[model samples]
Each structure stands twice: as C-alpha cells, then as structure tokens.
Target: MSWLALFFLGTFTGLLAGIFGLGGGFLLVPLLSALGIPVAEAAGTSLIAVWFSAIAGSSLNWLKDKFDGGKSFQIAFLGIPAAQLGVVVSNLFPDRLLKLIFAVLLLGMIYLMNLRQQLSEQETDIKLAPSPPTPGATGRKFYWWRYASIGAVSGFMSGLFGIGGGLIMVPLQLGFLAETLESAVANSLGAMVAIAASGLIGHAWRSEVLWIPGLCLGAGSIFGAPLGSYILPRLPNGLVTTAFRLLLLILSIYMVRASWASGWV
Candidate 1:
C-alpha cells in the first residue's frame, strides 16, 4: 500500500514538475509524511526521487530545445559544492528544529509568491532587447561569478530542504539574471539535476535515503514527466502561475499546522 501510494504521489508530483520545471520535492515531502514516514526520512527520500524526476523532465525538455546545457552546467558546478555544505549543516540541526524551520520557510515562500504576483500584475510590460555580444575578458568574468553565486545559493537550499531548488532558482534567474520566465524554469531544472544529485550522494553516505520508496516514486515520475511537458506549453501562464501559488499556499498552511501539532513549533 505504501509503495502504491508513493507511486501515485510521484506521478502527480512529476506531472507538476514537468509542467512547471519544479523539483517536485514540495509534493513528495507531504505525501511521504502522510504515509507515516518520519519527516527527515521523508525529506531525504524525496530528494532522491526528485533527482530522478528532474533528470527525466530535463531530458524531455531537451528534446524540445527548451534546455540550456551550458548554463545548466555552470550553475551545477557551484551548486553541487554548496549542497554538500548544506547537508553538513543539516546534520547539526535537531529534527524538530528542522521541521519548524521548514514550516517557516514554506510560509515565507508563500508570502513571497503572493508579493511577486501582485507586483507583476502592476508592472508595465517591457520588451526585452537582444543581449549585446560579450566584450572580451570583462563579460566572461562577470557572468561566471553571477552563475556561480546563483548555483551556490540554490544548492544550499537543496541540501537543507532536500528540494531541487527550483522554487528559489526560477525567481533568482528571472529577477537577477533577467532571463525570461520560461527560460528560467527550464534552466532551473537543469541546475537542480546537479544539486539533487549531489545531495543524494551526501544523503546516501549518511544512510538517510529509503531506496525502495525512492525507486517506486522515481518509476512513476519517469512516465509522468513527458505527460506534463506535453500539457504545459498549451496552458496560459497566468492561470498556471495562479494555480501553483494557491497550491503552495495551501500546502504551506497545512505543513505549519502539522508542525505545530507535532510540538515542533
């Protein structure tokens, strides 16, 4: 029954991830908890599942020319090391404290999403012009540092929360790198592949992953990713964004309440 539940959850999560280019850990963590797994265990298992799902989804996108391999690699290089550091830090925190922190982070994320939506609604549309050709040594250094910094932060979040870091990466890319939302989403997934991979390695070394459940979820996600990618491009961006934000808000509230009830607050 637990395996079946994991399979279904993974399918659903993968669909959302493929469509939105998310890490899918948001769905996995709650589903695992509902299945009676310990919170930290659930997080660790979900990270593994998310890594496979990201790979599958990214592959699908790559076939469609939606992925940027160079950008992805640059981000991954920095993010993987940062994720390792995050795992070390996570090990130092108590489980209850971690859960409380996760709850708080989720709430903050919900608020940020709302703020972004409101601000975007009020903003005038500005057309983006073509980026000027990079000039010699100056351009390369600037972009290298920028990409590395983004990767490190994203990686750290992945390690701390066992997430793929799309929730953080997408916004950062859009806001700081001035990338298009679609591009950011795609690129974020690419970066997540590396972050998740590194995190999984750390978790494995720490004996934190549950292989059976993770594999079950990954199996279902493999099928779901292509389906989500197929449906995503046809949907309206505003509608999709609204739906995602609402879902996150509901989940955040639920998680907060759950943490409180568990005396982790």
Candidate 2:
C-alpha cells in the first residue's frame, strides 16, 4: 500500500484505540487481509501496528494521569512473556483454523459484552464507586499473582487472534479488582502495550511485519488517541459498553461471513 494509505490507516486505528482502549488489531487485521496480505502475515503485521498504537495511546493516557505506570508495568511484566508463548502457539496452528477460532471468540465476546451492558442497565440504582484496595474485596493483596494470571490469559488470546485483548482484560479487571469501568478501560490500554510489543517482537523474528504500513498506522494513532481518551470519561459506562458491544457484534458477523466466503472456515 502507498505510504499515504498506511498513514491514514494508522491514524484511524490509533484514534479508535485511544477511544475504546482496544489494541486496534481487530480492525487492522481485516484491513491488512483486504490489502492482500496472507492471514498469518496479516496477523503479524497487525501486531506491529497494535504495538505502536498502544504505545502512543498509553503514553497519552499516562501523561494525562489516566493510567498508573507502576501498576501497568507490573501487568506488562506478566503479560509480555505470555504473549511470546502465545505467538509460538499461533505459529503452530493452521491460519484457517486460527481465523475460525478468532471469529467465534469475537462473537462470544460480543454476546458477553451485550449481556453485561444489559445487566448493568437493568440495575438502575446500582452504586458506582471506586473499589477500595482491600485484601479479599479488591484483590490488591494478591495483586501480582492476580494481574499476572490475567495478563497471561489476555496475552495468549491477543497473540492467537491478533487482538488487543482489551475486551477480555476490561471485564476481568471489573470482576477481579472491582474497578470502575473507566479505570478498567484505561488500565487495559496500558496493558495492551506490553502484549502487543511482545507479539510484534515474535512476528518480527519471523519477518511477518509490513513495516511501512505498520508505521503509517502508528503515526496516525499518535494524534487520534488523546482525542479518544478525552471522550471516554464523559460517557456513561452502560452506554459505552452497549455501543461497543453492538459494534463488536457487527464486526464479528462480518468476519464470520468473510471467512466463510473465502473458504477459510
């Protein structure tokens, strides 16, 4: 693709990542495939893009005090190694099967997102408070072990499917740490940087990244991320999750259809 095209893709993906706390790999992978990259190659290239975008977005969040660096770093240490392991496992699987699994997983996540949103909305008077850092309640007493386990799971999914794993991470944080949704989103974006970086390193060793396009996408994300992050705080949690879930559902269906049509199923 032309440098201009790559730049625009990067910018757009970065903006989305900043706004949604996504790695933006879900969008990047499909875009790369449409540009004629092989499935495995596209996944690898997408990881590079995701890494750049995550770094740019997370930096902005950090500067704005939207993320805690100490906490994020701890999670990354756990996630990064696991991400490499996931990349190795992905390399072993057939691309077609991998795509199919990704499609199904996306569908499942969309459904779960929707369910969570609905439940949140139905409980009209539910209190929205920042969870206290307590042993049994907050899981902070076992922070290292809990975050490490979460990071490992998230990293594996990210490497296997070329996704940011925020969809998984945010919910896990909410369930385990009892974090507010916005806090979870911010922290997830920070965690994604480590996961994407590890995956990119693994893919680079395999010569699977398309540097030009990946860089282009990264450049765009640099500007767009702050804008998205700015908007995230103003939105209601239920509304944000509902919109995100709907978008995921639509994207999931499109992926399923495209895979079937391509006989990759």
On lDDT, the candidate that comes out on top is 1
lDDT of 1 by residue, 1-265 (tens): 6889878878888888777656678777766666666666676788887788778768867999999998888889889999888888878886656666776776666665654554344332533335433236657778767777889998987887787777777666656665666676678778888888898888778887899989888888877776787899899987887788777777777676666676754
List candidate 1 segments past 4 Å from native. Answer: 111-124, 128-137, 233-239
lDDT of 2 by residue, 1-265 (tens): 6888777877777666666656678777766766667666777777776776677767767788898766677667778988888778878876656666776887788765654455444333345435434346455558767777888888887776677887777777766765667676677778888788888788778887777777777777676666777888888866777677776777767666667766753
As for candidate 2, its clashing pairs are 10-217, 11-220, 14-221
Error of 1 at 110 (Å): 3.0
- What clash count goes with each model? 0, 3
Model 2 TM-score (2 dp): 0.81
Off by over 4 Å in 2: 115-141, 230-243, 262-265
What 10-residue stretch in candidate 2 is worst by lDDT? 120-129
Model 1 alpha-carbon miss at residue 118, Å = 8.0
